[model samples]
Target: MKLLARLRRAFGASRAAPDGPAPAQDLRLRRAAIPVMAQGTNAWPALHALPIEMLPVVDRPLIHYAVTEALSAGIEELVFIVDRGKRALDEQLDLEVDMLPRGVRAHFVRHNAAQGVGQALLAARHLLDDEACAVLLPGQVTEARPTVLAQLVAQFQRTPGSIFAVEPATPQMTMGSEGLLETAAGDLRLASIRRVATSLDHRPPADARLWSPVGRCILTRAVFDNLEQMADAQSPHTGDLRDVIEAVLRTEPAFSYRYSGRCFDCASPLRWLEANLVQALEHPQLAGEFQHLLRQTAQFVPVNEDLSQAQARALPTGAAAVTGRPRLRLVRS
Candidate 1:
C-alpha cells in the first residue's frame, strides 16, 4: 500500500518535467543493466539476495537467461548492479561467466544503500553513458527466438522511444507488479503509452494488448534526468522505475511494444517455481526423467497433506530414491 501511495505522490506533483526522455532518437543500445538489487519491499530473507540471480532456472543460475537474452539482442557490455552485502551473486557470476564470449565484457556497479528499483538503476547511471541501455531483470526470463530484449530493440530501432516490452495479463498479474500502462491504439507492434497506473491495477487483459511490462525495457539516458527531477516531488527512497516511466510519459510520448515471446517472471515466488518446473520439463535430457518422477509422485500424493511434505514422504527414508530398486512382484493373480 505504501508503494502505491508513493507512486501516486510521484505523479501527483504539480510541476512537470522540463524536458522529455532523451528525444526518442535512433539511440543504439550497446549495454545492458541487470540490477541484482531489490525491487519493492518484498523481502525473501530465506533466499539471501534475489532467488532469480542465485537459484537455477535449469543447468545454470537464473541470471544466465537474462544475460543470454541481452547478448542475443547484440549487447556487448553487461553491467551488474550489486548491493554491498550480496557478494554471493558476484561469486556465482564469476564461476559461471567464464564461458561467455571473449569479445563481451562484464562490469559491476555498487548500489549504495539501494532502496527501490529507481535507486538501483540510478546507481548505474554513469555506466549507462549517453545512449540507451537495456534493463533486463533476471526474473523476467523469456523463451523466444529473437529474445524479449531483441524484440524491444527491434521496435526501438524502427521507432525510437523508451521501449516498454509489454504483454497481455490479467488483473491479478498486474497487482503488486509494475505499473500498468494505458496505451492508445497505434500499429500492431507499437502503441502510444500514455500513462502509468498510480496505484495497484486490477484490469482485465484484452486482445493480446499490452497491459503491463514484462521486466524488460530499453531506457534512455534521459530517464536518469527524469528520476532526478522526480526526487524533489516524492520521497526518493520510494521512487521506482514506474515513477520514472510516468515522468517520461508526462513530457514525451513513449511507446509500448507487445513483445513476441513468453516472459517467465521469477520476481513472484510462485512464478519462480513455475518457471523452474516449466523450463526443466522443456529440457531434452532431463524431461523424460522429470516427467516420470512427476507421474510417480502424483499417483501417491496425499490429498490433505502439504505438497512439500508429500514430496518428502515420497523420497526413500534415510536415503535418496534409487532407480530400478527391487520391489515386490505380484505372483499369478
Candidate 2:
C-alpha cells in the first residue's frame, strides 16, 4: 500500500469523490469528441515529433484508453478535432481507425487554428448537430470498471445537459489545480457548478475552491451554442472549454460527479513517466515484475559472488537478461 501510495502521487492520481446517483433512464450517448490540438507541447521534446495522444501508457497508446473508455460508455461515433500542423495525429488516426470495431466510427476534422478547446469543438458542431455527447482528452487517463465517461452518460438521462468528471481537491493538490466554486447536490458525490477558473484567468475568485476537472466531460447542444456565440463575438480572450461549460452551468443544470475511479494526468514528460510506472504495477503481465523491482533494496555484491546471481537479484525480470548496460563490479571495498 505504501508503494502504491507513493507511485499514485508520483503520477498525479486523482482523489475519489462520492458516487453519483443511478441512471434515471437509458441514456446512450452516440457521439464523442477527442480534441488533439496538442497545445503547449513544445516544452517537452518527446512531443516535438510524436503526437502526445499516441504516447504509450503500458501496452497501449494514450488514445487507446480514450477510445476504449468512449466505446465502453456506448459511444458509437468518434470525432477527432485536429490541427493542420498535426500530420502525426492524422497518420495515427489512420492506424487507429482500422483497429476500431466494425460499427465504431472514427473521423478527423480540422479547426481553423482555434484559440482554445471550446473553439476547436465548435468546428465540428455540424457533425454532432444537437445531441448530448462525451469529450475525452488524451493526456488524462482513468481506470474504472464503468469508465468515467460511462458513469456520466448513465446519469445523462436525468441531467441531459452537461456532466463533468471531478475529484476532490485535497489540501496537498490545491496549489496548482484549477479552482471551481460548487454547491452540493442531493448526492454526496454530485454538485452544481457555475464557475470554473482556468490557469489563464488573471483574476479568479478569492473563494474559488479547487476541484480539478478531470479531462473527461459530457457536453450538450447548449454548450456548442455558447461556444458559437463566444466565437462570433470575436473576443480576443477566447477561453478554453471550461469557460463554455461554466456558461452552460449558469443556464442549465450541470453536474460534477466525483468518480470513484483513479485518474492519471500525463500533462508533462515526468508525469508521463510516472503514469507508465504506476500503470505497469497493475498491468496483467507487468505487475509481478514491477512489484518485485520495487521491493528490492540497494546492496553491494560480494567480490567472489556469481555475476548472474547479482543481476537476477538486483535488476527487473527483462533487464537482468539485457546486454551492453553497466554491471555491478565489486572492488573489495
Candidate 3:
C-alpha cells in the first residue's frame, strides 16, 4: 500500500482526489537552459578528414544529436560553447537553420582560449540569466530512449536542485580512463574520484555505487556559483567540470539520476565508427531506403558471388524450398 501510494503521488494521480486537495503551483514550467559544449581543438579529429557535408551520422551532423535531445526535452533555448576556429560548425548551423523549431532560439559562444569545460561553461554565463535550471550536454554522442535530457528535466521538476545524469561504469569502461567516483551516504555524496594510478589502491565500498559522469548534466543556478569559485581556486586543467562537481557535492544537496545508455566519445576513431553504425541502424527513412536499394541490387547480381550464376542463386529461399520444383543448387556432392 505504501509503495502504491508513492507511485500515485509520483504520477500526480493522488493530487487529483477530492480529499487530497490540489498541491502547490506546478513547478514543471521552470524555464530550462541547455548548453552544448564542444571546445577542444581535437574533439573530433576524424571528422576533419571527411567532407564537411558528408561528415554526418545518418542525415544530420553528430552535434545535431545533442541539440535534438535537448529540444525533445522542451528546452526553450540552446547555447553552444564552441572553440575558436570552429567556423565550419557555425556555417553548418547557418545552412541548417530550418532544423530549429519555431520559437526556439540558438546562441553560439566561442571560447577564445583552450580552456577546460568549467571555463567554457563560464563563457556562456550571460545567457543563463534568471533561469531556474540549466543542462550541460558535453559533446558526446549518447543513445537513449525517452531521451536523457527529458529524464533529467523531469527529475529537476520533482526535485528543484542540481541533478546530473550518470552511467554506471564497469571495469572495462574505466580500464584506461580516469574519473571513477567513490560515493557515500548511499551514493548521495561522491567521496572522491580516482584520477591517477596511485589512487586505484583505495577501493570503493562493495555497497558503494561506481558512477561515471556522463556528458549530460542538469543543474540549478547554484552550479554557476560553484563554477565561479572553482575558477578562482584552480589554475585550470582538463577535468575542470569534475572539480566543480566534486566541490558542489561537498557543499550542496547534489543528486544524480542513473541513465541506461551507452555514450560514444567521438574524439576516438573506433567510437566514432560505432556511433555512425548505430545512427544508421536507428534512422528510419535512410535505413529503409538503403535496405530497399540493397534488395533491389541483389535481384540482378549476388553481392559476393560471380555474376555468371548470380540470378540462379539469388532466388527467394521460399521458392527454392518447394519440394516438387526443380531446385537450383550448385552442389559439390
Candidate 4:
C-alpha cells in the first residue's frame, strides 16, 4: 500500500493527501480560470474583444475585482490559470503586478488544453497543494456591503473546509443559466443542483429565494481528489464546478455561506448590461456622468424614495423616453 502511494507522489499525481510542501497561510487564493479557446460567442462579444477575463468592469479589467478581493481577504499569493490564446491576459497581469499591494505575489499557469474546471485546477495542482484556498471567477461581479470575498474567507476559517458563497437568485437569472442550486431547508448546505437552461422563454422556478453559486469559493485538497476521481472515471460532470461540488457534498463537509448582497451575472448579455448600469450608478465619481447620460437618453424622474420597476416607469418626467423599455428613470435623493 505504501509503495503504491510513493509512486503516485513521485510522478506528481493527485494523492489523497498533500504531497509537496504546504502553501503558506497567506497564499491561499486561486484566481479565475477561463479556457484557452472559449467555445461559442460571448454574451458581450464587443466588450469581450479582449478575452472575457480581460473585459472591463468600471475602469479596470474584470479580474481586477477578484484580485483586489483576494488581497483584501489577507491572501498574498494568487494563481491564475489561463490558456494559450489568452496571452493578452498574461501581458495585462505583468503590467499590473508592479502596482499590486505590497507582499502580494501573482503567478500565471498555462493550461492551453484544459477541457474543464477539473483540468484547469489540475494544471495548478502544485499551487493548490495547500490545505485551503479560495477560487474566484473573473467575470462574476458582486455589490455586497462587506465584500463577498472577505465573507467567504471568514466562513472558511470558521468552518475549516470547503465554503461556497451563495446569493439569492433572481427570476431573470434562473431563466438564463444552468446548475441552479437548491439548498437544504434549514442548514443551507446544497440539497441538489438542477441542470436547466436559462432561457427567458422558459418558465422560471417559483422559489422566492433560491441560493445560486456565484463562482467564489474556498477549496481544499478533498475537492481536488473528487476532480481527480471524475477525471479517472470519465464522469460527465468533469468540467462544471457545480457538478463537482455536488459530488463533493456526498463525502466531505461543504457549507454554503448565504450572503444578503446583490450579485451580478456578467456571463450573460442582458445581465451584463444590467450589472454595468448598477455599477455605474454606484460609482462615486461617475454618478454625474451617469446622470448626464440619463438626461440625454431618457426622462430623469426624481422620486422621494427608492422605487421598484413597476413604480419607477409609471411616473412622468419631461424628456423623451430612452431607446429601450423602462426609460431609465433616476430616483432622487
Candidate 4 overall lDDT versus native: 0.63
- Candidate 3 lDDT trough over 10 residues, lowest sum: 189-198
Candidate lDDT scores, in order, read: 0.70, 0.72, 0.61, 0.63
What is candidate 2's TM-score against the reference?
Answer: 0.73
What are the per-model numbers of colliding residue pairs?
0, 0, 0, 4
Q: Work out how many backbone clashes candidate 1 has.
A: 0
Native-vs-model 2 lDDT?
0.72
Question: Residues 174-223, candidate 2, lDDT per residue (tens digit)?
Answer: 44544453544344677777566543334434444446677888887787
C-alpha RMSD of each candidate structure in angstroms: 13.7, 14.7, 11.3, 10.1
Better of 1 and 3 by lDDT: 1
- Where model 3 places Cα greater than 4 Å from the true spot, the runs are 1-26, 29-55, 96-98, 136-138, 184-201, 289-333
lDDT of 3 at 130: 52
The digit string of per-residue lDDT tens for model 1 on 1-333 reads 998789879887444456744433455778998877633335455355454466677787777777878888899898888767656676887764686788988888787545666777777788885788888877567877678888888888887778888876566766566577777544567888767763344342353243677778887767788777676567445423576577576567777888786777665677767887888888889999888877765565556865555555556579664344334221221
The numbered model that scores best in lDDT is 2
Residue pairs with backbone atoms closer than 3 Å in model 3 (clashes) = none
Question: Which parts of model 4 are misplaced by more than 4 Å?
Answer: 1-44, 47-50, 169-171, 186-210, 237-239, 292-333
The RMSD (Cα, Å) of candidate 3 is 11.3
Error of 3 at 94 (Å): 2.0
TM-score of every model? 0.72, 0.73, 0.68, 0.69
